[model samples]
Target: MDLMIANQKSLRNLTVLIIGAGPAGLSAAIQLERYGIDYIIIEKNKAGGLLLNAEKVVNYPGFPHGVKGTELAKLFTSQVQIRKIIKDEVIKTGYREKYFETRTKLSNYKSEYLIIASGTNPRNTNVIINKSAEKKVYYDVINLSHHKGKTFAISGSGDAAFDYALTLSKYNKVIIYNRADKIKCLKKLYDRALQDNNIKYVKNISVLKAFASGNGLALTLSNNNRIVVSYFVIAAGREPALDFINSDKELENLIKSNRLCIIGDVVNGIYRQVSIAAGQGIKAAMEIYYQLNKENN
Candidate 1:
């Protein structure tokens, strides 16, 4: 999709640059717009980030009946139209003189301050390396509807894993696995999973090995139990997707200098939510604004 920021001004001499156009970055952009700061956003993909794939967002405030993830994303994006955008993946970012220089696949850019809200990527498992196991592993439930007739095993106990299982169980049998007896998800989700006949919970275990079987994959558990399923979904967790910055020294320098601000899910934390990300974005923008204002004065 084209990057469009409403009521946008010129970016020829912008001071701030935000990487990523997710909830955090966009929230920062909206705050910056209100403050009349000249800035631009560099996004590699669509503006929604991980929120787009969410099945339903009931926890986010202001929606009494709950809202779909895509709908919320649309509402968030409509708030601000950025002055300029570089719709390419950032390859390297480092400090150059008084500005932070960012290199992309297409060109280079420089800004006085930088905000990184690049968000996350799916965690990887080596179970799918064999060609035979290609279509048997999945990281998301976006395509679960297609496998309505097949049984699946999900490897995780958090909200995502349970949510996926609950949704998938409506059409197919689902087995949810966790390494411990205690789950980290919301109590409501955990209770719902236990009550669903089509959804089974396998606790205090881990997947030791997996191999492709006839039209499915066979997984051997830590307890030495075997279960064969048509698909395996790993919701174990996610890792920060920050392969763009090539130099550790550059990141460290930015951290020490207070020139780099990391917002949203990319930051290390126990929880991740759209509202929190948006609040962080606003906080980052305010910090930058005050920092720049102090220097100008």
Candidate 2:
């Protein structure tokens, strides 16, 4: 919640502008700081990205007992001690005349290098949703865990779906509906969910559409069945979120020239991991630092 606007003059002094504050972006900023680079990290939301949705980070190194998503996010951001951070969204970005130009709602920036760590956005389902019930639909259950004694319907077969179910089942009823016969999550998550009576996994079914019920949504399933729930959460999957930038030959050439780099979850596909993102961030910062040093010499 460190949202703030930057002056045009402050932005122009940046050598590199990073568009995200997730683990990858934070790592890049930390590395840049170590190298005495003049850079800025911009983010529209709090810095965790999808990592904030994780229930328990068991695979990340240095945490033998596993850590909560929010807890780890705190640690990541705390370590950065970021030099310059713009708490605004990047509205447009592109490369021209040897400089990457980025515009946010409040300010514009020109830098020698640009790093897009903007991560992924939730993949939308093809199911049509009625306007009346649209307000009750969500893609992630991050801050919705405190609600007690209400029914939640989750759609998807991936780990996110099951994870959402587990998180909500702690205080409410959770039913995970999957269109596919086989679930895409790990067996351990499935087994744990099955053991909890509050969580139910319904296979071979999909939420085709949803309409307004009394105070909730009456979901119409693909098999012509109906069920009502307080809210509908979709954990289908995610894809790269780069809609803010225009796609053109010039942008492609910038990438090809290494002046503009897209790293972290934006390009990692299914290999998304905190460690991988952090390593890539550090490497990109190093590369940018060396390139700038070579230019000065």
Top candidate when judged by lDDT against the true structure = 2
lDDT of 1 by residue, 132-220 (tens): 77677778776565567889998897888988887688789999889889898899888988999999898998776667988789888
TM-score for each of the candidates: 0.78, 0.91
Please list the C-alpha lDDT of all candidates, in the order they appear. 0.79, 0.85
C-alpha-based local distance difference test score of model 2 = 0.85
Indicate the residue-level lDDT of 86 in model 2.
Answer: 66
Question: What is the clash count for each candidate, in the order shown?
Answer: 3, 0
Write candidate 2's Cα lDDT for 1-297 as tens digits: 012224546556468899998889888988988998878899887777777878788889999998988799888888776447668988877665566778888888888889999998888779888999888998988768779999999999888998888888888999999998998888988898999999988999999998899998999999998999999999989999898787777777777766777889999998888999999999999888877878899
Off by over 4 Å in 1: 1-14, 82-87, 123-131, 142-150, 170-172, 210-218, 223-228, 246-258
Mark the regions of model 2 whose C-alpha exceeds 4 Å error after superposition.
Answer: 1-11, 247-253
